[model samples]
Target: MELPGGLGGNDAPDGESLPELLRSWRNRAYPREVSETAAPRRRRSGLTQRELARLAGVSERWYGNLERGEPAEYSEGFLDRLSSALGLGEAERSALYLRAIGRPPTSAVAPGSAAAAGMDLTLQQFLDNQAPNPAFVTDLAWNVIGWNDPLREWFPWAAQQGNQMLWALLAPQARKQLVDWEGSWARPYLGQIRYARAQHPDDEALASLEREILARSAEARKMWNLREVHEHADGDLRRLRLPCHRGREVSVRIVALRLMRSDRLRVNVLMESGRAVGA
Candidate 1:
């Protein structure tokens, strides 16, 4: 059967037109049965172009032009809004961005007045409830925004160094405090920074942070040149040698959780092992 918008084939042809791809997606999303009546019956399962336009807060004509492959340039903001309206997941969002724009959407959300607002009260309370376990929250840039009392008590320098990436890479105390500074903390942290830099190549704040780290620390420059990337995994073990606790080493399990409503803010909790020395 011929699908609406001329997208009836079992699979999209190789090098299929962008308009065809959009139409195919729309037809699949909003499948309808055409009856042998004077007027073709329209079934409503998925969003119509008009509904999508309304949801995205754009003119129906503009959205229709896009589906029809009309020559039109769309802003990133518009594409992002459209993606949200379509209820696209991360992979779908990335595909939409790649098709609409030449590049994939950045993982780093645009910083604005919201950045000043910081984590939501509930998330802050969640971190605070971690209690004896050191817990903190950070934005995509790893800027320390919220922390529990245990973190402040254990790592006094954390209060001074607002950026976790900077402290891990540049601070002298970090090398002394972390058990496997190069292997565990410095290298992995540098890899994380590199990944963030890749996501927001145009962000001045992130760029400046990278520059500052490279300029201040020779080690960071060397690691930056390596161009390694790493993702933090939950339940990873990290050992810290606390100066306040007379050089006692403690093993802590890492627990990282992302806040969905906010722009990639993560809560990191360090649960001390039962065998942890210097409590």
Candidate 2:
């Protein structure tokens, strides 16, 4: 939590109060961010502690005490409200929760929110260069943001809606191509969605996706009810009925990679376990 102008957190002289979190909060712009203000100036200025407290529905004294790092019981909900009031970014809010509560918030946050719908050229080129091998990149919510042509031979719809979970669970192509669509694809993906929904209960998109899945697919509804959950299919084996192999059964191992810059960006490369001759 570095302060502006290279000032340390405890660099406050004599009487003027410039607490650590207070300084951070004072830099958050919202509600009264007039257009004429320069970006640097805006970054250096924001809501007053009293104004912020009012917006957060708390008294100035309470906000001051908390900002001053006075030991007080802080609830996640309260911190969440404060975060909303301050218009904090996801990382900033998470840091605040950790600082105040000694733990990160339990809310399900999209891992690569900083790069939402972003396609990195290095990653895309890497995927494109992985010829013959099936490779692709997906965001935290399984949104396919990048892929190779080889992957398209496996999943032609990857570039369509760009959501792997939806494609695996509800797409007609998945039913035709994925071996044992219920056991192999739908159920597993539904479990993943279920886990995501549980972790991010406040996410309306996940909720809406869950509803659409339940409404469109009977198998998904059943699997979702089983209460199964897993983080991801990092090293799972899956069989596919390949069009490239003239509908022959092929087995592949799933290899999952998280980017160093953003853990939420998943790079999945399929390693073939078994091959079938084209009929």
lDDT: which candidate is best?
Answer: 2
lDDT of 2 at 50: 66
lDDT of 1 by residue, 139-223 (tens): 6656566777788777653432255776567656678888899888888887877777787788655665676677657877787
Candidate 1 residue spans exceeding 4 A from truth: 1-117, 275-279
CA-lDDT, candidates in order: 0.63, 0.64
What lDDT does candidate 2 reach at residue 90?
A: 71
Q: All candidates: CA RMSD in angstroms?
A: 18.5, 14.8
- Model 2 global lDDT (CA atoms, 0 to 1): 0.64
Which pairs clash in model 2? none
Q: lDDT, candidate 1, residue 23?
A: 63
Q: Candidate 1 lDDT (Cα, whole model)? A: 0.63
lDDT of 1 at 123: 73
Task: For residue 244, give model 1's deviation from the true position in Å.
Answer: 3.0
